[model samples]
Target: MTDLVQQAGIKLDATASSPEEAVDICGKLLVELGAITSSYADAMWEREQIFPSAIGMGFAIPHGTDESRAHVIFDQLVFVRLAKPISWADDEVTCVLGIASQGDGHVELLGNLAEMIQDEDKLAILQNSDNPEEIAQLLLGND
Candidate 1:
């Protein structure tokens, strides 16, 4: 597990209802959590019309790789939770991790994130925690 994923990463909430709603919710969540610009939350909805960033894994990792954000330091892994159930094309994911990354390193970061999710202990811990900080610690404990 990476350090960022443990501290200011995996543990969060958005109270949204769908992947589309999650985009804005996640953006505001980052601002609330003090990790992203206020405008970042609204960025996803605009870009989704071009190419949907919904990646399935009982999770939807949305992002903005659009032209405007091209040169910004967009390396961030944010968390979002639907206030109600949301369906991805592949599966219904209650949890979403919205990544705003602009570097090739995201490939490796994604692999690690997958590994973190796959770990049985980590999975159970995160699944059981209501508090985001505990969830984050559970995710990072493996590291």
Candidate 2:
């Protein structure tokens, strides 16, 4: 998972004036890494249209629907920390975590992520870190 994040790319302190731009930043990285097709980004946007991805505490997980799974070539995760918070529906989001998985791994990934963020210290690190590697370590327990 950490390798996927390193390969997919992480953008720290990135500036995006809107939620769409934030999602685009992470999606583009996945596309560049060949983890997903270009259309996957649009799929993410469409999913967002159906329901906001913001999960709370300034974090948002933007992903495509099962129908968009066809665009996924591999399991990948892209983390982006915005330079400023953007409105994702009713929530203010500063971190956009983009996920592209081909199978049930996405469910496991989300489960792990949920557990990780439940720790206040870990959540603080994720919300405040400016180093991509450090953030990855904090999230994936690579440290």
lDDT of 1 by residue, 35-107 (tens): 5565555676666666666655456677664553553354556665554557665567767776665556456
Per-residue lDDT value at 132 in model 2: 73
TM-score of each: 0.69, 0.90
Q: How many steric clashes does model 2 contain?
A: 0
RMSD value for candidate 1: 3.4
lDDT of 2 by residue, 1-143 (tens): 54657723788888999888888898898998889998887899888889889998788999998899899998888888888898888888988889887777767667767887788888877888767778777656664
What's model 1's overall lDDT? 0.59
**Candidate 2 least-lDDT 10 residues:** 1-10
After superposing all C-alphas onto the true structure, candidate 2 shows an RMSD in angstroms of 1.6
lDDT of each: 0.59, 0.82
